[model samples]
Target: MKNIKIVSLTACLAWMLSLMLFSSCSNDDANAENSGGGPVIESVMPSGYNVDGSMKPLTPVTLVDPKNYYVIHGKGLLTTQKVYFNDFDTYFRPTFVTDTDIIILVDENTPFADASNQLKVVTANGTAIFDLTVAPPVPTFSGFNLINAVEGDEVTIKGKYFLDPVVTLAKTATEPEVPITIVSSSLEQIVVKIPANANHRNLAVTNISGTAVSKEAIGTALYDDKLYGMQWGGPWSGKGVNFDFDGDSYQGEKSWQWVFGGWDGGNWGFDVDMTPYKAMRIAVKGTKNGQVNFSVNGGSNYVIPVTTTWVYIEIPLSALGNPASVTMLTFQESNNDGGNTVLFDDIGFVLK
Candidate 1:
């Protein structure tokens, strides 16, 4: 009876030890899973579908397009904290994250996106780096400054994707293209000198990606000089008159409130000879039917009729005594009775 009792006790002790060891091992495994070791990026893929709407396989891609969705294959992605394209933060969804996959959307407004294509992923455990080639969208042509420009004058073209641009000018669609000298080039702007004999026909820019042609002829000119392309003036407040760019055209807004003395003005003075040009052409639009006065050399006032729509007002230099040297050009609005607004653009000279 004594030997039987000892054997039973030993068996019970052994069983308890086995249970304790098993429990310990199970706890360790749970902790390991909760920690989610360091993140590892395997590959990046683009998401798209076929015509039938069937899901496409997550094939690896080297290039990424802005404003598009992509999938990242990796481990420990569930704990991802952030994703960056270049230095720009992008959007990602935690719900889309799995132990081995993550979904992200590249930001459309990523700065210098094509210039720097390094993608970085961060997690609590570790970070991963990937090299991506970014393909930017095709270029766009909005408009340019100095619509009527003379030879040797710098004309700035504004738009998008101006990388390694090639600028050309022609008198008409049928004329041969003439290359203009580029003074500077950037992603959104290019400054070039108007070549001699440029016919003011069509101005176009071609980059490696695409091309943009102006909708209208830049305006006729053989010898032209731009005084104010809406890039001047001082700080003042009244009924509120200001100069700004409206994407498609330069604008001048003027209010004839009593607080503003019922007038707003801007002036430019240069030593350019106005004898060669026939008239000063200005593109303007007003709130209602009114008249605005323009003065050159602080001399006679040239009254221009304003309509609700835009119209070109040509003031003959001959009307201002055909000044031998242009000292100043002034624009003033004082005819506002109850207050009025106006927009002006393409302030320059027209060749005879």
Candidate 2:
């Protein structure tokens, strides 16, 4: 009899448990019917939405119908939400859904959320609302030309749309890659130093945003050998020779002063103030025997060199080594009897 009682009690308990589960499931079905089965998307959060992810000052979003959107606080129906892009988590992978998308509306410090057509929607039904994209502005370079230049000469570069602060010069067939010194800059102009090995080089502007490259151009030239020339003097006229007549030889029976001052100085001379690379060259002809004399400090005396015929004289002020200012050059009669004539011509300077 006790076994029968135990079995009957166990059966009663199972019957009661089944009744409770069935009642719970019936209640859930009745609630679903009352609420219309799912959250109704009566309105969208952002109305007339258009924004660029790459643009500064990211755009804001709004609700098409604030009352119907079911906003939690100030945000829209899907308000107080999180966005993920490109991955499963919202950490560092933030992506935009098109150039103008909802991702742009997120705060800067918020973690980037993984995004997908399947990952979008209200987090209830997996549905994609917007596409993600990025639009970076294309950079351009202008104002480029090949200037007459030497290998190590310094030069200035001018251009437009150099948005980046730093400038890059790519290596050429004749020169190595180099970066120019950024002295000053503007929207349309940038001033930088030409590197020592810069030649036939390609230029570019760089920053975090993008780079702008200019066509290759030659470096700039500073010094040339054409800085000096020659001229012919009198016997032709009363006026002195202007270093314009290019003659292989010149002859005269009269003494002519090869005035090296003024423009003829080639901007060179001896100086108490130590300067650099100053030189003068005057190829003179004594057609016959003559004495070449030089003086400094106003001709109190003369240092003479007796020459036999035409010869080249290179009077590098550097060789003179800190001589007095206002020096003089004169060719006189070899016998010192006076009236002996000598010719002077072919005046030039070496600039290197």
Candidate 3:
């Protein structure tokens, strides 16, 4: 019985030793899995000041700037596959990635939408998602093409971040506030019409990001009596000829389309005295490099060179013998089967 008791004590001690060994091995395996298995994001920091690889305090910003580099802190991030800021996929270099951190740059063309602001990091093991904020830059108003625009004129506002912009003309103490009609808009440009009673003190543009007011007041006019603006003359005749008041243009905020098919022609006729103007300027954009003939008052034809991009073709009024009373201005394309398309805008006289 004494021998049996000593054997039982030895067995109990062995079992306890075995249990401790098994627990230690299991803890080591769990640590390895946590370090090597899935990705984990702890914090994000700007790449400029993250020189020592230490996790900085997370930014409290609600929107992350585009085109800026940021560092992410985590574990199991060495084999990162992709990274996304909001809905935009950004670039991440494996060389810049490590087991506990990642470097990435947010794309510039990311669209602003009402989607999740979660930053996602994908890896072979799993994905790590963190709630983030990303937004576009605020709208900026640099200047406009036409500083002095009339009521019926389409003014082109040139700036950045013009997505879904709202343009308004400031009201005077006497005059009521007027909202300018936006004819068309793009990411960098916006075309708006000057209201009839607009006392253009300040031009304001608001977008999803923010609002920007012009630095200087735009000169508003009721009518430009000196300039005879012929925008998209629809009275002309030509095959495949089309005109749109809200098309792509390099001048006057809009363009007219003229499709040429074997000697197509168009003209605008008016009974007026154009002796005051020294030259006639026509902004033209063509499909290819070519030449078009223009005639004034049915007199000598002046050849104007056109190219694939928008160009101003200024013809001296003396080329047409400086007619005192002008009756017609005509344009004719060369005969060809290529069916070239041309865009024209701002056909008027300038004082040189």
Candidate 4:
């Protein structure tokens, strides 16, 4: 497959300027170009530069990037009134329309899921449709399972835009990247086998659109199924803490559940050097919607909004008073809805 081109803003402007020049031709020619009864799409190609810094030709395309320009080569397009990709009514300039071509940019807001995968061109007389695919955006690295995984263990990554992803352990100063074996994959998830010679490294995933590197590297979990470095379960006033809640596992084999009442909280004791980490990340959902006061070292409280469905959140260390060490962690029922259960998983710090 050919490399996906990167369209520069300057080149895009140059093309638009050329379109203005095309529109400056005689009115007789414009009248003759717009005389056709129906538009007929011959092909579509990218309007961007090749990977080698050369201009891309008018070769037919199978996939078009969002927010990128492309040339629609067709007949009777001088009277082109509207353009749509995957049923999205994308805008196009009349000056960009000609007898056999319409240069347009794919809208960034076009819906990419569960819709018609075809480009439609409507002219004054009739309409035309062609099979096409709008490429997904870059991968979003949420979190991964088995946070303390070692070589040859299986790890599941949770995120979106994993289309045809290439998974690899990011390269370190001492060694090159180690490619992980894919056990299975989907648009939102990937299960992989940690390869031999693997270290505690971040995973990098790349699809056709772009690449994404995980925030939390392998083996950096404060809690996956259970809390790490747990000297104690809770502060004196906390209640109903479950170490292994099997009802749902957002990241690993289980999830941490807290049943708390008004003014109650769960506290755990640990001694972790927070210098190497940047942010605290977790996937949380509640029996019902609410908020919790999340903190470390009993410092400042960061209000975390919870929902019925799990929402992954990353709180920067600076927001939590930037403690140098973590001796105690706490989560208080701040938005008390009488009493409720909150589920937590993928609980860990983002390695620097």
Candidate number with greatest TM-score: 4
Residue 121 in candidate 3, Cα distance off native in Å:
2.5
Worst 10 residues of 4 by lDDT: 19-28
- What value does the lDDT take at residue 193 in candidate 2? 62
> Tens digit of lDDT per residue, candidate 4, span 1-352?
2444655567766765664454455334644665756787878887766668777775789789886778887667778889999999999978667777788888888877666889999988899899998888989987787778888798899899887889999876766887889999988999999976654688999887778887677878888887777887674464588879998977667998888787688677888888878888888999888898888888988999988999989989999999898888888887745866888888888876
User: Of the pair 1 and 3, which is ahead by lDDT?
Assistant: 3
Instruction: Kindly list the per-residue Cα lDDT of model 1 for residues 118-230, writing each as its tens digit.
Output: 77889988888888765555678766766666788888888887767889984453578889899998888898998887644667888644568864345442112322333
Model 2 steric clash total = 24
In candidate 3, stretches whose alpha carbon ends up further than 4 angstroms from where it belongs are 1-61, 74-81, 87-89, 98-100, 108-111, 123-127, 136-164, 169-196, 199-281, 286-288, 292-304, 308-343, 346-352
Pairs of residues at least 3 apart in sequence or in different chains that clash in candidate 1? none
Q: Model 3, residue 252: displacement in angstroms?
A: 10
Error of 4 at 63 (Å): 5.4
Q: What is the TM-score of each candidate against the true structure?
A: 0.49, 0.26, 0.46, 0.65
Which model, 2 or 3, shows the larger lDDT? Answer: 3
lDDT score, candidate 4, position 7: 57
Expressed as tens digits, the lDDT of each residue in 162-277 for candidate 3 is: 76788988555666657899999887889898877543456788876678876445542111222243433433453565554455765445566777765677776666556546
RMSD in Å for all candidates: 18.8, 28.5, 17.6, 6.7
Provide the global lDDT of candidate 4 against the true structure. Answer: 0.81
lDDT of 2 at 189: 66
